[model samples]
Target: MSWAVLVISGVLEAVWAAALDRSEGFSRPLPSVVFGIALAGSMGGLAYAMRELPLGTSYAVWVGIGAVLAVAYAMITGAESVSVLKVLFLAMIVGGVVGLKALH
Candidate 1:
């Protein structure tokens, strides 16, 4: 359950980040609201997850998932240019996350 919450939080982090990017410096009403909600929700979820998970492990996984998802989202949405080197780096991040998970 804690891990699940962490993953959700991470995904929410990505969502909020993307929302913030579209907020036009907070001038856009709808995107601003969405950004606020998602940002708060992500932090709230992370707090809940930290109750049971070790801080180091939880933080690493949370950040890793958020970063990877955000980059992938940007590439897929055409918000950023996708390149072979970028994809390779993203794959390395995924690999690191999986390796960390496999650690005792």
Candidate 2:
């Protein structure tokens, strides 16, 4: 359950990140609201997960998931350019996340 929450929170981190970018410094109402809601959810989930998981492992996993998803989202939406090297690096991050999970 804790791991599930942590993963969900990680995805929410990406959502909030993308929404924040769309918020344009909080100038946009809808995106800003989305950002706020997602940010709260993400943090709440992270805090909850930390209750059962080691801090360093949880943090690294959370950040890894969020970073990969955020950049993937940007690339898919054409907000960021995609490249072979970028994909390769993202795969490496995913590998590290999986490795942590396996170790845990």
RMSD of each: 1.1, 0.6
Clashing pairs in 1: none
Model 2: per-residue Cα lDDT over 33-80, one tens digit each? 999999999999999999999999899999999999999999999989
Taking all chains together, the TM-score of candidate 1 against the true structure is 0.92
Error of 1 at 23 (Å): 0.4
Please report, in order, the local distance difference test score of every candidate based on alpha carbons.
0.89, 0.96
Candidate 1 per-residue lDDT over residues 1-104, each given as its tens digit: 88789989999999899899999999999999999999998999999988988788888888888999999999999988999999999899889877767882
TM-score of 2: 0.98
For model 1, state the Cα shift of residue 21 in Å: 0.3
Q: In candidate 2, how many clashes are counted? A: 0
Measured with C-alpha atoms, the lDDT of residue 1 in candidate 1 is 88
After superposition, candidate 2 runs with Cα above 4 Å error: none
User: Which run of 10 residues does model 1 get worst, by summed lDDT?
Assistant: 95-104
